[model samples]
Target: MSHSVAEHEPAEVTESGNANGAGIDLKWLSDRVEYGLYQDCVHCGLCTASCPTYVMTGDENDSPRGRIYLMRAVVDGRASVTEKVRHHLGLCLDCRACETACPSGVQYGKLIEPFKVALEISADGDDRPPLLLRILLRHLFPYANRMKWALIPARIGMKTGLIPIARSLGLTKLLPKTLQRMEEMLPPSMPLLPPAPLPEKLEPVGKKRATVALFTGCVTDAMTPETNSATARILQHNGCEVHVVAGQACCGAVSYHSGDENGAKAFMRANLNAFDLSKYDAVIINAAGCGAMLKDYAHLMHHDPEAARAAAFTAKVKDITEFLVELGPVKPANRVEAKLTYHDACHLCHGQQIRNQPRQLLGMIEGLSIVPLEETEICCGAAGTYNLSQPEMSRRLGRRKAEYIDATGASVVAVANIGCQMQIRYYLDERGGSHEVVHPVELLDRAYGPLPGGTA
Candidate 1:
C-alpha cells in the first residue's frame, strides 16, 4: 500500500481555461470536479489498500490511486475514457472507505461523482439505453405512482399462478435473470397508498423543542409507508412538530447517479415546491438515500438562482437517526427482546458518513442484543439501480451479505435503507432463511406500543 512520489509537478489549470479551448475543457472540468484533490495526494497509496473493489479484483485499475491517475490523465489530455477506464469507474461502489483511510484528506466521493457525470455525458447518444427497456426504466421505475400501478399487474400475475406458469413455460427465463429476480422479489399484493398529506402544520406533542418537515420519499412511501408513520410518531414523541409534505416526489438520487441530470433537477425543483423551507427548523428524512440528497441540495442546485436559494433553505436537513441521537434523553421501552444484526446502508454509512448513530440509538432499547455484521460497509449491490442493471454482480454481493447475516445467527436483520432492505430480503427469501428484515424505526415503534394500524 505504498507508492513512490514523483517529483515532477503537473501544470495548474484554471477553472475557465480549457486544455484545448475548443468549446470543451478537460482541465476546466477536472478542476471543477476534483476541487479538493488538486495538491492533496502525496501518493502514499493508502486508499488502494482499503478499496473493496481493489481487494476483490487485485487490479490497480480498480483502486482509488489508479482512478486518480486516470482522472489526472483525462484532465491533462493524455487519455480519453476508453472501455477500460469506464470499466474501472463502473466497478467502484463509491463506498467512501478510501476517504476515511486518506491521511491527506482527499474528497474522493465528490471528485468521483462529477467524473461519472462527465463520462455519462460524453457517452451520450452513442450509449443510448436499449430502446424498449430504456423507455420502461426511465418512465416507469423512477416514478413512484407508475411503479405502484405496474406492481398491481405483477401481483396479479403472481397470485393467479401466471408468473409460475410463465416460468414453468420458460418465458420469464428468456428475460435477464435480474428482471426475473426483480419480479420474484416483489411482495405479495398489498394495498398501496400515497404518502400521508401534510397538515397545515402539526403542533408539537409536548413542549415544542423544534419544528421539522419530513420528506416521505418515493420508494419508502410506496413500498413501506409505515416507516414514515413511525418516524412521525417518534418525532412527535420527542417534542418536535412533524409536517409530512406531500409535494416532494422522488429525491432524484437514482436519476442523478444514473446520469439523468435533467430528471434529477426536475425532481429537485418539485421537492423545493413541495416542502416550505422557511417554516421548519430542520428537514428530517428517514430514508438514507433521500437524506443524502436533501443534505447535498446546496451543491445540486448551484446552477439555478431560485433553486439555489431553495437548496440553501434545505441545508439543515438531517437523517432521522442523526436527529434522534441529537435529541437526548428519550425513554426506551422494554419489549420484544430479540437478537438482531444491523446492516449499514451504503448511503447512511458511506454517503452520509453516519456509522454509529443508528447503532447508538438501537443500543438504548432494552432486550435487543446487537450483533455485528461482517463487512458491514460493503455495498449490498442495491446502489439504487445497480441490482436492476448489474444483476449477476448484485446477486453475488447480496448473497455474500446474506451469508454474513446468517453467520451472526440473528433472527432480525435491521437496516435503515429501503434498497438494502429489499436486496437483503430477496436473497434471504431465496435461500429459505427464517431471518426477518426490519427497519430500526419499526423496532422502536414496536417497543413503544402497538403501531397505529396494529400492523407489523
Candidate 2:
C-alpha cells in the first residue's frame, strides 16, 4: 500500500453524514496531528519487524506504516472511519516500538494518540469502551485512594486463598470480561491492606547531592507501593533528599491513552499547580509510562498559555535509574545473590529511549547475576490498560514473553513498569512458572540498607 497521503481537501466535507460526506471534519486532524508526521513515514517496512501487533497478526493494517496509511487516508478523504479501520488502529499497543525502529524518526505517538482521541469522540455507541470500563478507567484507575477501596475484595480473596478456590471452581468465569482480566493480573502476594503513604520528606542519608521530588503514580502507587517506597529509600541512600510532593495526581497517561483528553489535561493542570518546581533539583518517576507522559507534557499542550511552564517542568523530569546513574550511585555493599533477567518496559526502552540505565543499576548489586532474556525489548502486552481492552492479544504476547523468560532459566524477572510487572506475573503464573517479577530499585534498596525512620 502507498504510505503517502495527498493534501486534505476541506471543500469536500459536509456537516451531516449525507451522500455528500461521512460527517467527519477530517480537517480537525490537522489541529491535533501535524501533516508532516504522517509524511515522515517512507513505508520501507523496517518498523514492521519491531511492531508487536504486526508481528502477532501478520496483517499490513496492523503494522505502523499501514496504520499511518489508514490514518492519513482517512484525513485526506481517500477513506472513511469504518469499523475495519478502527479494528486496525485499536489493536495497536501504542508501545512506540516503531519509533525506535524508524530511520526517518517518524513520531508515531504524535500521530496515533490524537487519532485515538478522535475515534473515542466520533465512534458509534457499540465501538467505544464499555460503560463499566469507562467508570473504572476514568473514575477509579486515575484515583489512588479509590483504587485501594476497589482492591479490598481482591486482597481479601488472595489473603484467604479464596481466589485460588474460585479459580478452581470456574467461579472467575462469571465476572465481566474486563474484571476477569483484572482478576487474572492481580499479584498473588498483595497485602491484606493498601500500602502506606510515603512520608512528606525523607532526609538524605549523608551529605545531600540533590533534592528531588518523587512522582508516585496513581495505579503504580496503589498496586506496588513497596516499589514506590523503595524508590524513595533508594534515592535517599544515593545522597538525595526525596520529597513526596503533596496534592499531586496521576500523570494523565491513563486518561489520555484511554481517550479522555480534556480530563487528562485537567489532571495535568492540577499537577502543574501542585508541584513547586523551584525547590527540587529534579522530579523522579519510577514507572516508565508516567515518566514518558510527564516528559511529554510540553508537547501535549504546546498551544496553551501554560505551555512554557509545562516545558520547564518537563526539563526536570527523569526516571529513577536515569537520575541515579547520572548522580553517581553509591556502590551497594550488601549481596542479593539471585539470578534474574530484565524485561525492558516498552515505555522505558522505546518511549523514553531508556535501554541501559536499568541494566547499569542492576550491575552494581554485589552478587546479582544478569542474564539476557530473549526478545527483552518486545512489549509484554501490558501497554497501560491494554490487558483489559485487548485481553486475547494481551494474553498471547504475555505468554510469548513468559516463554522467553522461562527459557532464560532465571528465577526472577525485573521490570520498570507496574503494568509490565502485573502482566508478566499473571502469565508466568498461568504457565505454572515460579519466576518472581520485581522492580530493579527494590533490589537496590535491599543491597543498600533499610529505610532510616521506619518501614513504609
Candidate 3:
C-alpha cells in the first residue's frame, strides 16, 4: 500500500521565486487546484486498488492517493514537475474511480482535472498533444456535423468492406499513428444505421407524464446515432414528451478534459442558453460522459456570472438511465433473450454514481439475463480520448477488460458510454471474440419496439 516518492520533495513551485530547485515555475498549479482540496486525502490507499493506472503499473505515482500526494507536494512548494512526476500523472485515466473508492470523500476529479489543465498550460511546448489530435479535439469532435462529414469515408469503407480488407491486408499502417488508432478503435458501423432524428417535439406515446429535453451529443448523433434515436423512443415509450433542441452544442467534456477550459466553458454557455431549463422536468443525456459533464456545469462555471444559470441547468441534466428509472420505466413486453454482461462506463457508475439504474433498466428486459462482470466499474481504457492519447496503457486495460468479458461467456456486452462501447468492441474484435457491444438504451428500445402495431 506504500508508494515511494519520485524525488526527495524539491521545493514546490512558487510565484515569487523558484521554490523548485530546477526553476520550473509550476505556479499555475495553485491557480487551478484548491490548496484545501489536496488536504482531504487521508492517504488510506483504499483508492489505489481501484485506480486502473495503479493496478496496471503497480507504481505509487499512478495510484490516486499517490497522485494526490504528488500534486499536494507540488502545490505546497515541496516538489518539482519532473519528467517522472509528469509521467505518473499523465498515466491517469481520469476515470474518477478513486473518488468512488475513497472513504474520506476525496474529490479526485476536482483535484486532477484542473491540475491537468494547468499542467498543460505550464508545459505548453514539449508536452502538447500532437497536431492531428489537437485538430480533432478542437475543430472536429465538438461539431456534430463536422464529425459526421469526417466519418463519411470511414462509413463508406465499412459499408463497402474496404476498411476491413485494408486492415486485414495491413494497408492502414501507412496512415499517421492517431489515424491508425482511430482505424483500430472503429466499431462496426452496421449498428450506426439509426432512425432519423426525433422531430422537434415528440408527444408522449399515450399520455404526457413528464416533459424533458434531450441532449443529443455531438458524437452521439454523428457516430452512434441509434442510441440517440433509441433514447428519444424509450422516453416516449415511458410517456415523456421529448424535445430535441436546436443550437445545443457538445457537452464540452471533450474540450474540458483536453485542457481547454475556456473552450469548454464556451460550449457550456452555449448549452446553458440552448435549452429552457425551467420548462423541462429533466434534460436527458444518453452518453455517460456528456451526462457527467452536463451535470458538472455548475462546478465548472462556479465563479462566472452564469453560475446561477449553470447551477439550474446542472440540476435538470440527467443520464437517460437515471431519469428513466426515476420516472418509473415502462416494462417492455418483448423478450431480448440474450446472455449479457454490463460494463460500467466510468462516468456513469462513478461520475454520476449511477451503478444500479442502468442494471435496473436492463433487468426490465423480459428474457435478458444480466451476468456479473469482474471489474465492471473499472474503466475499459476509453476515458474520453485516453485511448487515442495513451494507446499502450489504453490497450493494456482494454485487453484486461476484454478478457473479463470473455470469461463471462456472454454473447452481448452492454455499456452506457459511447467511448467505452467502442473500446470494448475494438478489443473484443482484436481477440476474435464475438461479443456485441451496445448501449443499454438500445436494448430497452428493442424490447419496447413498435408498441403493438405502430412503427417505431
How badly does each model clash, as a count of residue pairs? 0, 0, 3
Model 1 misplaced regions, further than 4 Å: 1-39, 124-129, 158-171, 176-178, 188-204, 307-311, 450-456
lDDT of 2: 0.87
Over 112-162, each residue of candidate 1 has an lDDT whose tens digit, in order, gives 776776666566454534454556556766677777666767766867878
Q: What's the TM for model 1?
A: 0.86
In model 2, state the lDDT of residue 83: 73
lDDT of 3 by residue, 411-444 (tens): 9999998899899999999899988899999999
Instruction: Tell me the lDDT of candidate 1.
Output: 0.72
Ranking by TM-score: 2, 3, 1
Please report how far candidate 3 places residue 40 from its true position, in Å.
0.5
**What lDDT does model 3 reach?**
0.85
Residue 59 of model 3 has an lDDT of 67
Q: Pick the candidate with the highest TM-score.
A: 2
Mind giving the per-residue lDDT tens digits that candidate 2 earns over 1-456? Answer: 223223312222221123334325566567878898899988787888899998898777788988888777777666677777778888999999999999999999999988987887777688988888888999999999899888999999999999989999999999998888888888889899996798899888878899999999988888899999989999988888899999999999989988788899999999898889999999999999999999999999898889999999999999999999999999887999999999999999999999889999999998899999988988999999988988889889999999999999999899999999999998898889888899999989899988566433
What do the candidate models score in CA lDDT, each in turn? Answer: 0.72, 0.87, 0.85
